[model samples]
Target: MADSIFKRYLEKKNNLIKNRGILQATYVPDVLLHRDYQIEEIVDIVAPSLNKDKPSNIIIIGQTGTGKTAVVNYVGHELERADAENKNCRYIYVNCEVIDTPYSILYNISNQIITDPNKKIPFTGWSLEKIFNELANYIDDENKIFIVVLDEIDMSFKKNGDDIFYYLTTINEMLKNSRVSIIGITNNSTFAEKFLSPRIRSRLGEEKIVFPPYTPEQLIDILKNRAEQAFYPNVLDNSVIPYCAAISAQGSGDARKALDLLRISADIAERNGDSIVTSAHVDYARQKIELDAVVEVIKTLTDQSKIVLMSIIKTPSSNDTGSVTTGEVYTTYVELSKNLGYNPLSQRMVANLISEMDMLGIITARVKSFGRGGRTKEIDVNKVSNDVFSILSSDDIFRGMNLNQKLKKQTTLM
Candidate 1:
């Protein structure tokens, strides 16, 4: 009887370990799958320009998760190593998401130059103008050639427009000693060109490069590399990682997606009390990761949008309806909103709300054309049906809802 209990315990423990997947980004090694040629091309573009005519800036463009940032980051380190003998050239990477506006971008560059670690500019929170002047002074004092990389350049442009890019590119003209060059990286190919004025565009369009998606085979190699570091010996079925790589390759050739799948698969494996990650774990992980992503995205919606989404979840045939008509969804939206204390919105306004939810990926809209008579749009809730109900009913306004009943209502509608 003791032996039997111990055997059962071992089985459960082994099942737990198998559920955990290897191959997460934070844990993955840097063996790039399909990016070798792209990396080398970028290195050539950014390598210390012998002429010192302000290291010419380069822009990299690709779809999301296509290794745009990773390639640039990897190349930056290589450039640093290659240029170690030449003290004049330096590589600096800035995530525009964090630094944000052009002033912040320039200020960050100035701080890097000052390198005091604890030093601050004397001006006490002056306007962006005064800050720029101080930053210019610092750059002039440094007497070094710096290449700054702005990742997520698209986000910066969307937030504050091209004024920052204009400033940074032109600021070097004021410097008597140091010179500045910039490398803008983005997932949006049309980002810089669309946002900048012709003159600013002219200055920045100098050396443009594009990184393409990885082939499935390449992604498989990438998965293998990450798995070696992330998993125990023979923990993952050989086919599972490749299966994940193949899925991500279809979407955007995103290494991040592949890595996320591998990690989530392992977690699922651990939860199921398995000793090895199997094909089943990978499939389950994909659905789970996708659902979680949709749920988190929906949670961030404005209260009104969430209300509109919750209304759809309770609608008849949520997916088959494509989208609930604004007219159809508005009544439920209002009831939920009133319970939540929001003033009911007009149908025209509800139309806007539908669009907002569509943008958040919580729902999709289908417009029915009435020839010249006009059009009516319908809405469909996508992947967040389970959580949308929870968010809406969590408020006292939805206190009477029986979750099982609501679920049944959803079933009947579908």
Candidate 2:
């Protein structure tokens, strides 16, 4: 019998990564560097729960990858440990991004507190009011202080409106034996002011803590800590960690991005059978990460927004730089929408969609004054990759459409 093809691949040893999970964004380490102040503040607020008192509802605000979730997770773990003897406290964490709707959010919390299989809430079919009542009753029955952490709280608010917030913030009024304190973690600092009413805002934002982005130095310390645990000694070049940190700091100071860069760089090196990960590997990882992020964002765009983006892509530039005016994009959009047998949106709507894409980094829209022509946005697609074109073409609406021919048609019209 022939040797199995997998045998050779399986025989290859992993020299770089000692423990891969340590490098992941989800891994909560024994120690979190550079977040002592934030951790202490959260600890102070939740300390009252140890004595069977309801702690203040907290709003933890920070940009992505600034360690908001990690700090909260760390504090919850510590809080659980301190209350291990009393058994009067319980910590429940629900990621609002996943369990988004009020029904699912309430259902998730109820199940966590209610241990009996027969007593647990069903996944669906119940009205929001019934689910809230059931969750409230279950928690009150347990008679324990529940500190619920709602991570990415703004996502749920944006999707389902403020009803969930109103229910959760006012839940305490409905409970008697048990007390529920909410700790909302959000990337948007203005989430409270923008989407929430004054009453809901006051209750939910009882206390707010903002986490600032990490500096390059702080990022380096974070990378060093993770690198020691993630990679074998001497497997990473001295310059690799600093390169990843510098690149991430230049963008959003996102430690998660820095960690991802390091992890992917090492993986790339290992795949190539290289002994040491280098700056070149980090560069390749950066490009791969950026392309993946852009593609994912493009995938989630609304169908109308996708068509508007396609219109921008097909529209011929007035100059050699491959940039088109918003008016040109709208013209192409009208034609494309008609070709696909879809109703064309107003020019104003198409222009707004273009601006949204620009904000998402898929395209660049710059304002240019044509004097008597007034002001207009000059759209550029230099940042978009071939992969994006493939994704757009794969859509059922755009499958049979001749995008190139449409481009030529727009050129002829111009």
Candidate 3:
């Protein structure tokens, strides 16, 4: 008498993870905790839309996982109650991180609003301008209010431009009846402050809400609420939520990270044949989560950026200062690019990537000066070099490169 593979797998899985999806960042609980003021404020901002009037545009500024997206989604859908004329008001959400291009953003919105598959603009055939025109036409025809929530909206500006935003803000003038307004959610408010032109900034900044990082106690409450729903009874120890909450709060009160830590610790505990998630499980889960995040960032990097990172990793760590100079990194980057038969980016662009990667916490970089003459950044690979090396080595362009061998190989050949 042998058990089937499926039977064994199910039995093991059922030991934990009663509902894995509940723990995901995307899982929007019916109610959010400790955000009633934000909820009421957001509702009040978009309230005019209930009467078919254009609502005030909003820029929701918050550190990651303070419930920015959940609040808007909850409020947007609730606000979509039909008007007196039976106009079908809508809440359309777009993750600018995914739909980062102008053409793609317009196409997604067009497809969502256009009911007829045939009448919908061909995904490829329409010029971006014509697509924009057609998108505006379709929405105007609906004569309904549309509230668009652009999450990670900063990414859209970086990848594309402010053109789509400009159009959204001004599109109402083109419409005879319908109104389209945007609620932008972003992790970096400074991007808006620095990058957006004054005209666009003022338009979107009409009303702004900033969600501060959750206090440790707030995170504990949030994790506790989510854990109750995500795990079966007695699955988590009383201290588990508090520990995860404290760790996450230390890193800017990221509730999403808290949820992830909690969920992953449960999985780790379950895999270890433990019935209850414990604090040690949380520590192990934190390491895995952090490494996974860096791996993801590395994977999404452009080939040039990957090589740029590889250059920094391959540069010999300074014994005296423990960091490489920008010049040293650039030299390594150029050599590696030429080694792989790819033209290297200009030193300026490589420097820019260094700054970007530094911001991503991949490296530590600070400017140093040669008195009265010049300056360059002193760059040190953070402890995540192992994770970075692993991810880059897996990619085709970066294959066959090893930090230990890279310096030796280039030294011998050059």
Candidate 4:
């Protein structure tokens, strides 16, 4: 019998990662770095529950990887540990991004609180009001303080509306023997002011906590702490962690991104049979992660947004700098929309879409002044690679149109 094809690869010893799970974003450390004040504040807020009292509803706002969710999870874990004997406090974490919608959110909360199989809420076929009543009754029956952490709470608001939030906030009023406290976690700090009604906002924002972005120094400390447990001794070069932290800090100061960079860099080194992870590996990992992110963002864009993007892509540069004016993009968009039998958005609306894409880093739209003639944006698609074009082209609307032919016609007209 022939030796297995994987025999040689299997024989290669794993020397780089001591425990890869330690580098994951979901892995909460025993002690979170650079978030001492936030942790203490959360502890103080929830400590009332230990005495069988309800804590105020909390809204934790911050950018991605700023330790908002981590701090909440850490505090929840510690709270549950402290209440193990009396069982007066219960912690439930629900990621709203996954379990979005009014009915699903209520159902998820109900299922968590109602653990008995015979009394478990059905996954579907129940009205939102019914689910809320069941969830409230179960909590009141337990006579315990329930802390429900709604991570990415903004997603639920965007999908269904603020009704679920209103329900949760008013749930305590329905219970006689127990209380429910909400902890909403969101990346959008303005979510409450923009999307929520005044009543919901005032109730949910009783104790709002804003988490600031981590600086490069803070990111370095975070990465180093995780690195000690994630990698073997001498596996990572002296510069690997610093480089990862600096790159992530330069963008959003995300500790998760830094840890991801470190993990992917080590993976690349290990795959190449290298003993030590270096700054070069970190560079490769950054590029790979960025490309993957761009592809995903483009994939999730609405069809209209994709058409607007394609118009920008097909627009001819007005000068030798390889950038097109917003006017030029609008003209191309109007013609393309007409030919495709789709209603063309107004130039102002198209400009707003362009600005949105600019915010996403899909294109560079810089305002160029024209003296007294008013200013227009000079849009650059330098970051939109062929991979992006392919992703957009796979859509049904784009499948029928020849992008190259459209570009040629636009160029000839220019």
Name the candidate that leads on TM-score: 2
Residue 383 of model 4, lDDT score: 66
Model 2, span 1-414: residue lDDT tens: 988889857887988899999988778888889999999999999999998999999988999999999889989999999999998899999999999888898999888888989988998899998999888888888898899999999999889988887888788899899898999899997887787888878998899999999999999999998888888899989999899999999858899999999999998999888999999999889888887887789888998999998887777777977788999989989988888888999988888888898899988899999979888899876664455666678887798776645332221100
Decreasing lDDT order of the candidates: 2, 4, 3, 1
Model 2 TM-score relative to the real fold = 0.85
Clashing pairs in 3: none
List the candidate 3 regions with Cα displacement exceeding 4 Å: 1-13, 82-85, 297-414
Candidate 3 lDDT, 103-173, residue by residue in tens: 88889988989999889777687788788889889999998888888899899999777887897788888
The 10-residue segment of model 2 with minimum total lDDT is 405-414
Residue-level lDDT of model 4, residues 1-414, one tens digit each, is: 998999978898888998989988778788788899999989999999999999999999999999998889889999999999989999999999999888888888888777789988888898888888888888899999999999998898888888888899999889998999999999997787798899999999899888999999999899988889888898888998889989999858898898899989998899889999999999889888987887788887877788889888888776877788899999989998888789999999999999999999888899999989999999876666555666678878877777755332222100
Alpha-carbon deviation at 173 in model 4, angstroms: 2.3
TM-score of 3: 0.77
lDDT (CA) per prediction: 0.73, 0.87, 0.83, 0.87
Off by over 4 Å in 4: 3-8, 301-320, 324-356, 367-377, 386-414
Model 1 lDDT tens row, 68-169: 877777777776776677666667788989888767776776666777767665423557777787777877776767788889988898899888888878
